[model samples]
Target chain A: MWSTIGEAGEFGLIARVTAQFPGTGDVILGPGDDAAIVTAPDNRVVATMDLLVEDRHFRRAWSSPEDVGRKAVAQNFADIAAMGARPTALLVGFAAPPDLPLSWADGLTEGLRAECARAGGAVVGGDTVAAETITVAITALGDLGGRPPVRRDGARPGDLIAVTGPLGLSGAGYALLEAGVLGPDDARRLVGDSAGGADPGWAACLREHRRPGPPYAEGPRAVRLGARAMLDVSDGLVQDLGHIARASGVAVDLDSAALVPDPALVEAAALLEQLGAARRAPVEHMLFGGEDHALAAAFPPGTDLPPQWRRIGTAAAPGPEGAVVTVDGAPARAGGWDHFG
Target chain B: MWSTIGEAGEFGLIARVTAQFPGTGDVILGPGDDAAIVTAPDNRVVATMDLLVEDRHFRRAWSSPEDVGRKAVAQNFADIAAMGARPTALLVGFAAPPDLPLSWADGLTEGLRAECARAGGAVVGGDTVAAETITVAITALGDLGGRPPVRRDGARPGDLIAVTGPLGLSGAGYALLEAGVLGPDDARRLVGDSAGGADPGWAACLREHRRPGPPYAEGPRAVRLGARAMLDVSDGLVQDLGHIARASGVAVDLDSAALVPDPALVEAAALLEQLGAARRAPVEHMLFGGEDHALAAAFPPGTDLPPQWRRIGTAAAPGPEGAVVTVDGAPARAGGWDHFG
Candidate 1:
């Protein structure tokens, strides 16, 4: 068995990794070529890319190789989903030290294959190289299915801003992990509280942080239902909403009362406070927590929101104070998640 | 004025870099969204990705930020071209240290924009992240113009192998650069020879090493001309030909007499020898040296080659031994590239 990537060498490792993937419906050509061809039936390809650098984006001490690979693909696919497209292809560029275990690479490939299949995409093509640190760069391509691309600048004044999917579990999960409530072991070993392992809510946060499940199908649904502007909440809700507001040239005001955290998510916050890791309240996490990959969009005024979506805010004329996004009529500070910050 | 990447922050850097890119034809949407939509007129998108890691794939001490950026993009676009496609969109995932100069980042963006324009592609969307070393991960999308992709496995026994574009200049150039003959000072200071700078041949080698100009158009032309198998000469000629030979399940025989090096390229090898940097003959450079980004293809027997392509080899039944690619009736060793090796 190949022990390290150095022992397997580049071509050998590539052949082993790519052979595991089963081609999906949209793939006209798969790996082992100069490039792979994927069907973009709407005459357009929706594309986005994201990077996960070791120690900076994820630490081996915290997440498994599978978690890293899945997270890298999941986040980028969420962008395609936000564009009202269905994921079709994934191209990954992986750089790691030669000393990295071959088993680790296999796990990463398995994770990429599983996630791409789950999102209805195929692993198209990738390049592997040696680097000082492990870096996973993923580009996800999607087909818009003939619908016009849903954009952030489409929101208009008097539009109802709605959200779909869980919002703060990832953030709460991160806190739990950082607080040592969940560590190298699974959630079963909650320090000094083994019974807490039964809490599906707490476990969900941990799972979401490792691999977020975005509402991919809901993106196209929103577009079909006449939704105007949309984006995935990869960054905090406030910061991401600020993007829509600025792009749409409007002010967004959130109804904090309408923003209800899942009772289990609130329980996660309570648990974080129990471990003295709660820097913000549970509602704050719902408002500002990021990486939930939740779809947030603006529908025409009075358009019936899908049962899967919750109307959490409204778009209006720009406020005089220069704040594009506000909560309960007050300008809300958008914090968390800045690579350079 | 902005100095380092940290001072500009992630969003500001993204905005600054993206602003330099003028929109191209195939782009349905540009940056500043979750994802960008690109036209894929044939309903198929040719996709490929490559990574350039600092020190591993490029050295800042030797290559300017612009050179690194151009090389990263050129290599990936070459892959697209090899698929018989025209490059349409480019998505970059850049991870760099916080202390990296913002001007360097700007220069990199300028280079990416310049190359993408030359290839007729638009800068779609990308992510910037913080990492210890600079890594440029590029995913290129291309349109096949309704042509079936020219694959490596299509070659048959009796197919004539042909090559287009200059070969081994990059390898010769790399030797010159590594030998202290062409360092710090652009070709202006050629170590012990000042007059050598006036020689365009030597300068071409240096320039080609920094930014390869693959004959991208020739790829589609080869397809149009009924090429059965084709690939870009990224690794050495022997190494890359081995890919086609193995994939097509045929033994390949090269006619070294047909692979006459460019007079100028041969001059570069002589200059490297003059500087005591020549590790092999000029012809050997063409044989085992790589990174020329030239197109090599297998055409049907009795087919006249386009003026751009020169017949250099022939596909034959597999020999008794395991060697798939041979030179002058003898097994040729395939070396030069293996990230792990």
Candidate 2:
């Protein structure tokens, strides 16, 4: 029963949002000041920014405000994790229509706080303004914890390529959403039916589509274990591996057998089949789906990977055509989501 | 002729934009990586963010792509400066339609780089995405250099209130622009007429309206000289001072005679009069106009002000109504631009 943003006023809405996120951890100066002061401790700070635009990046019809907010924070924080840095703080710039409900704004703030908490960071500062469309721009700051950042250009020949979290689940979820098997109304109902364990696979994919749970801690762990190069699987695994390949002046060959689908994805495939979807191999989704947010890294050959890490590929000297990424010794097609494509 | 973003493709447009901003200064890792790494020599970083939406915060007809980019960086950096810090790096999140001209994006990047150089910072990282409207969200990170941040809550009774940059000029320029006496076409011509010094007053006002030159270095200087409290005059002199007064639990009394307008504003008034506009005191503009980005600070009583700083008022114990700011012994109205207002 909250009033709209126009009725609550900008300052009033800001106060309400700030109250929800009291300063925590190394934040010397939090919101309500000119700028937030964050303790970097190591004399270096890792920073990344991302912009999510309505309809282009997300649809209000499909995502609740909370889902939108969580996704915004998650993706940006994933970039920081990709650098093998522990996220410390975030600054959000949100713009939406004046007539939007204040409850929606509150939901968005709660979602942001929840995601930042999961990433071991806090929402230190932000700005909100009125605009015709909803736009969320987030800047995530991270602490390297006295470690050198794991850059994409540092991989060498004979490195082992690995992944720390699930891939292709988000892509499968997106496919289900796009096929209208689980519409917005059904998705909202499913969100409330936590105890109704019916169709767990469908629910898991839908949840992944709405809010990704990136393995944030594994990033710094990989760096600590001497990861030569690393990045997040935001664009598909093949596309992002191609980036590391190009940056490191090497070629990567991913083993198709090693790119195994998780149990949830296997269930999601069955659900899609029951829902009359065309029998496309779920392995295709595993290879090309975007927004997985899994940490992909290259470590020295014969290095012991942590239990959570799974070997998926190997890096080698480039072939005749400069740097390339292949699947089972064949050059893989570079297909991934591009904003302007 | 440059192709549109859709035709050029996202990666091509990004390459074009990134080429304009080469990394400089304390940037350990610049753009095109997973994230940018910046040195925070003092072990702390001052961070602030701002969002500018097309038509809501600015008009494409009025601001060139370059002006828009510069203004976006300038305003966010000014917030860091207001905290008594030297800006070190910037992260930009830009969202525009797919059909936006690639040349415009390149011009925006060039403008951002120029302004960041002025503020002694570099555009270390950024993200560009497709959206329905053009939106620029900039996050500025700053170094405090082992000095304490001059916060808005530190003002005390008997402190001298001062400003380090011109006030109301941007406001006066906005008035002229709104009245159509200085239309966008004329303003563009004025920008190009660098050597044509005729009507210097009109040209100055127009220039200030397009791009404000805030006293960035003076912020840390004020802190070194023991500024009691500080903030930027972004939301009008009276309104912003009121924020300081409320935060410090004190009252501020301004001498109206000391709130002097520059000669250009006086000339602008005459021009508006000749244009048959409603006759109003230009002082109102000085007290209420927004987006100036001038620094306002409170110093100890009887302190010798620096050459650039001008004392205009004194802080005192709060009046019966608690914290307040008055002009010429009259309580000033708290009227300023609010996004939702």
Note the DockQ of each predicted structure: 0.88, 0.82
Interface RMSD value for candidate 2, one decimal? 0.9
Query: lDDT of each model, Cα atoms only?
Result: 0.86, 0.85
- Top DockQ model: 1
Tell me the deviation in Å of residue B281 in model 1.
Answer: 0.7
Please write out the lDDT profile of model 2 over residues B150-260, one tens digit for every residue: 899999999999998878888877777776746534533534443134565655676777888888999999998899899999999999999999999999999888888
The per-prediction i-RMS, to one decimal, reads 0.7, 0.9
Q: In candidate 1, residue A328 scores what lDDT?
A: 91
lDDT of 1: 0.86
Which ten residues in a row are the worst by lDDT in model 1 chain B?
Answer: B186-195
Candidate 1 residue lDDT tens string, A91-160: 9888988999998999899888778777888787898999989999999999999888899999999999
User: What TM-score would candidate 1 get against the native?
Assistant: 0.96
- Give model 2's TM-score versus the native structure: 0.95
Candidate 1: deviation at residue B82, Å?
A: 1.0
Give the alpha carbon lDDT tens digit for every residue of A289-340 in model 2: 8999999999999999878999999999998967998989997877697788
Q: Candidate 2 overall Cα lDDT vs. reference?
A: 0.85
